[model samples]
Target: MADRSGNNKKKVNQGATLKKVFERLGKYRIFLIFSILLATVSVALTLYIPKLTGHAVDFIVSRGNVDFPGVLRVMVQIGICTLVTALAQWLMNVCNNKMTYQIVRDIRNEAFHKIEILPLKYIDGHAYGEVVSRVIADVDQFSDGLLMGFTQLFTGVATILGTFCFMLSVNVKITVVVVLITPLSFFVANFIAKRTFSMFKIQSETRGEQTGLIDEMIGNQKVVQVFGRGEDVTERFDEINERLNRASLRATFFSSITNPSTRFINSLVYTGVGITGAFAVVRGSLTVGQLSSFLSYANQYTKPFNEISGVVTEFQNAIACAQRVFELIEEEPQIPEPEQAVVLKDIDGNVKIEDVSFSYVPEQKLIEDFNLDVKPGQKIAIVGPTGCGKTTLINLLMRFYDVTGGQIKVENIDIREVTRKSLRAGYGMVLQDTWLKTGTIRENITMGRPDATEEEIIEAAKASHIHSYISRLPKGYDTWITEDGGGLSQGQKQLLCIARVMLCRPPMLILDEATSSIDTRTELKIQQAFAKLMEGRTTFIVAHRLSTIREADVILVMKDGKVIEQGNHESLLEQGGFYRHLYESQFAH
Candidate 1:
């Protein structure tokens, strides 16, 4: 089922969105003003052709009594007008294209910048695909609508005004007839447009959901197949696709009505002008040439009404898409880093977690009144059951999440008082979930210390036990990989991540299940490397594998977010507590 609960509540103020769009357009006001000026010249010259044609018709007062020179002169002028009109329109379109794309470029840049500074909680709460759709898909949709409006909407309105002035100059009676029927087209288009906006908004949202679902399912297809969830996911996808289909149909059906309906009204305006002008010709108040001019003006005037009506529907859809794009650009970002914040340098790794309290949600407590202190070069291993806040503790220590109460200090300086960039630079973190950008293997390894020597890159890879595998590749360390490290096994990706941290060799390190993916033989080799790497560096290891942390200087075993046991491997076993039970259970199996 569609998420229809908030259908009536507007997601964004349309007025605000439009105002923002105009504000952006204001940045290129020179181009916009130039385009409009060209459009006016185009319309004015095109409208003048009808008057010149009327003059050409009047020159042929009576068949062979025709003044060929006068007719030829008017014909030349009409031809010149047509040529200039085409040139002006071409220039106007060029300006429109340039301005439209520049606006889209600005919007995309700002949206990406906003995503970079958004709080982690915001990212965690929304689907990755949904955010991607807004930046890529939604902006593209907005671009199409905007381009159409710029190309057609401005000229259509201008033509309508120009035609009205030309028609009035010929005869007021025929001009009034054209003007009277024009509002009928506007009324019909407005009625359809009002209904289509909501449908189009819903359609855009459904499309975003569809994009998000496809992204998630495709990215994790292996897990889906392992769990036999192909049909289940398919069924869910069909439901969303069906909703998008229905929304698109409704929006398209209603917006589609505006074109033919306005054309019908415009046709009536043309008919009325013909009939009224014929009567005026018979009464000698209008010449046959004047009647011909009025009929042409009627067609030109009414034609733009049809065009404008069509563009109004497109404009509605554009506004709906712009609302989504603007919402993303305006999402609450991370709290600003303070001015005069201390930049951590030459740091001794002495971490102190004071009476800290935290929870993902205020209503449900997770970790409360937690405290821990570590001296420089201490190897602190955290062991806990699932949901015991082991990863959360790491998040706090890295200042990815600040403690709700009290504070955490590095080198006795409160972490909040220090610049996050300089503070985070002091620690090297290797997580189980490995991420590699699309680049050569050497680039991935040297990500942390790009200035490292070729020998240092090889040394870090060799230390992490990945040099052998990398050396076997066709391109050696120059081998290209994707963001997800395509064609590489999970263990290989983890090894690369380890190599990244190894290359940095910061004063503090975090290894959160860093060796989880490697085989036992490789794990042992990497552990030996880690043993050397941990020397004189404060390291926090979050591990479920009890045997791996046996040599930790202190083991903090936790349950329900509180450390239940605080001791080393041998003493914890002697105590026969929760730590021993957890340790023995793994071996017992």
Candidate 2:
């Protein structure tokens, strides 16, 4: 059974969505008005041409007096009218294209900026390629459809209305028939449009999913090749690609049939009008000139009905894409900034977390009543089994997420009291999963501090033990890395990230499994440098390897989001609790 309620909701949204599209264009309403006026005049001129031709025919042949002057005069007027009509139509199209692109550009920019402000949770929940498709592919489709829709809209209306009024003045009886059949075009267009709108929406969504799959498979191509699971990946992609293909085909099939179906109905109306007017001419109720003009007006009247059906079909597709674009634009942004926020400044880096609680979802608490305190410069290690909220703790500290309960303070001020940018600026971070954009090595290192001198950059690199590797490269620091730092080993990428942190030289630091990718020898070589980096700064190290945190002044043993133990390595070993068991498991082997 058809979903009556669903259909009703869709109908309501359809009206609202198209209204939104025009509202965006309404920013340039003056241009739209000029385009409409030009289109109306163009259609009027074209409609009047047939009447002049019929007059010339009557003057030359029907009167049997070869009035060449009258015929030539009518011909000249028709010639001038057609030329002017064509020119006006050209200018109208130019305006339509301009308006279509300007609106699309604004919409694209809005969607992109929205992505930047959106919360990390929102981005994490959706696939990257899916978001990109809406920004790029969907926006492009909306623009193309609007260009066609706007170009045809005014001309279609003016042609239909002008032809009807002219035909009515000529013969009301035939004009009545034309009016009665116009509903056929509307009914057909509306029916197909309603049916196709849902299909187009599904198609847009499926295309995004398919794009996401390709992005995922290609991004992990190395893993796929090592496991030799290319066929499996391709099979999964094929399933999504096939679904997209079916949805697109259905949307296109339904919309494609509208124009021809409307045309068939329009042809029937034209035939009936021609036959009735012929009989009227023979009976002397209409003159031959007027009968000829009625035939042409019959065609003109039906043409817009046909064009309107096609434009409606295209506009329906555009509306589907526009709805998706608007959804992203309208989504609530991340946590709102405080109206009277303080900027974190010149910090000694004393940190305190008291009764802090957090949860990814409301029902299942991830971290509950967590607390920690650190002096201005202290080395702290966070160790736990996987999924024990170590990463979650770092995320909360960075303000990527906010604590659900309690407060985290930096230098006695609640972190929430300060601007996120300035609060984050107090810390430098290096993670296991390295991020290096497509740029030269020097550029990547200096990304955190763009104004650092070359010597300072090299010093940071040497501190990370990556300077020797850079010196050996073909272009040293000037060599370009591909997307995601392709062509570099994982260890090299991590070293570059460390170099980035060294240059940042923030008052606080977080190293989350930061050296996991580097070899033991290389890591040992940088141990002193790491110590130096930690000097005079509050630091947090999250590590699975117990060897790295032996010298930490305080070691936090986390289990299920709560700190289960806190002490120096020797004290934790003496306690023989969870932390001792974990440390022994690694070194005892």
Candidate 3:
């Protein structure tokens, strides 16, 4: 029973691996067709060579002399066959390269598109380096396998079939001697391939882990330096590297053995065919020309077999890569866009959260039966201790994640019923961590609406209180920023983000700890800008500092995942609830 189960599992794995390879190839049907045509021509040329040589030998012997005309004719025919094979080989390579490039391009584009729509939850668990490897390394392997392996496979099979038929026509008895060795060679090659495939899979996985570690170290270099944990990181990386090295060595060792072993088998077959053909000629069952032709066919047959073994080994490595890519592509997205969704138009931003419940995981709920209603143009503040689901609330409201239970509505319609693009377009957000792309200040602010006029962009910058700071720079708004805006202070970046949001002019706005990193002077200016920006828009503020939320029309004090108190600043203080305690603790300082 155990043996049967293992066999069944192996069969299933093989089927899945083959399916993945075919699916990737299906994207390049035109290239595949051209490859087949080239292979056919090449195989036809290969098969014709033996027949032409046999005719030349028979003619020389029958004439009982060295006939110069016949010899010249035979040499010319052989040359023509060689030229045709060379041309076919070249065409096959061109088609193979083109197909591989196109397939890799499509895989990369699809992976990138998928990554764009993936939720923050999916990204949190994966390293940037690992994601990059999936796009580059894994996809490249799939392409290499499909192009090189498939080409060799088709050409090898054709060569074998063509050679076998011609050999049989010359002498059936000697043909059997040559053909008998093939099944044994095939079995040995397959066994080696299976072992090599196991090692390659391990190597691929270890490489991905190593890549992930490298990415983490680079991303947190600052933290490592501050904590003096560089030695620890090095040791950890060394461990992963050692494992990868061992796996790679094993894969190489197994794969390397395949080619030499196949060559040795071919050599043995060559000797056997020569000996057998000699005996047949001596017995008067075969002519000298027939024996020569049989020998040529034998060499042709074994050459492709030898080449096929190497290609098959490469194919197995490609299969390993395909497995990783297919796994990523098959993962179910955390949040899916709705079908037949309505596009939100002219949003008035009347936000309502009706008894919403949410959790990053099933066992640990982050928000439970949370309810709130905000009128258009109202300013609501959410104040809570750290990890009390403040950020999660914003993520849910933005549809970055779906609520576990209940509904969130905007403009009296359930958020899930609206297209994600239209839903997100109604709100402007400034996150706690300001991320700036590599571009100028003007480019960053105008990113939300590329079609906005120059005057409109400048006006938005002024509204965010950042126009004067940008004007002070030598290049003004055209001054380029480094990746992550390395030249700017945190406050400057935050102000830039505020300007970006202002340019969009959404009906609803969210400010998540927008002033936490700014100095007091900049904070005051930014607060004034926020006040002006929130005048006629529905705004949700998540503030750690109590002073910032003092002017809020409503304050919701939360603990764990539930709202414990809800009222205006003075009203909540009079009630002497959680809000009052939070206010005294934060503001009394």
Candidate 3 local lDDT, 1-589, one digit each (tens): 9988866875576679787657777888888898888998899897898788887787775545777798789889999999999999899988888887877787778778888877778787788888878878878777877777767887998898889888888888778888888776788789998777767878888888888888888877989999999999999999999999999999988888888888888888889899999998899998888888888889998998788888888887887877777667666665665688889998877989999999988998789999999999999899999999898899999998899899999989999988999989888999999988887878888888999998999998888778998899999999999757777888889889989998898889999998888889878888888888899899999999989988999888889999989989899999998888877887675
- In model 1, the Cα lDDT at residue 435 comes to 89
RMSD of 3: 2.5
- Give one digit per residue, the lDDT tens place, for model 1 in 1-589: 2445443344346677889999999999998998989989999999899899998889988856999999999989999999999999999999999999999999999999999888788888888898998999889988888888888887888998898888888888778878887899989998888778788889989988999999999889999999999999999999999999999999999999898999888889888988888899999999998889888888888888777887889888888988988988899887777887999998879999989899989998888888889999999999989999999999998888878998999999999999988889999999989989999999999998999999999999999999999999999999999998999999999999999999999999999999999999999999999999999999999999999999999999989988888999999999999999999999995
RMSD of 2: 1.9
**Residue-wise C-alpha lDDT for candidate 2, range 373-419, written one tens digit per residue:** 99989998999999999999999999899899999999999988889
Looking at model 3, the pairs that clash are: none
Q: What is the lDDT of candidate 3?
A: 0.86
Segments of candidate 1 deviating more than 4 angstroms = 1-12
Question: Residue 541 of model 1: what lDDT?
Answer: 98
Which prediction has the highest TM-score against the true structure?
1
Better of 1 and 3 by TM-score: 1
In candidate 2, position 581 carries an lDDT of: 98
Reference-based lDDT, each prediction: 0.90, 0.90, 0.86
lDDT of 2 at 208: 86
- For model 3, state the Cα shift of residue 525 in Å: 0.8
State TM-scores per candidate.
0.97, 0.96, 0.93
Candidate 2 wrongly placed segments (more than 4 Å): 62-65, 472-474
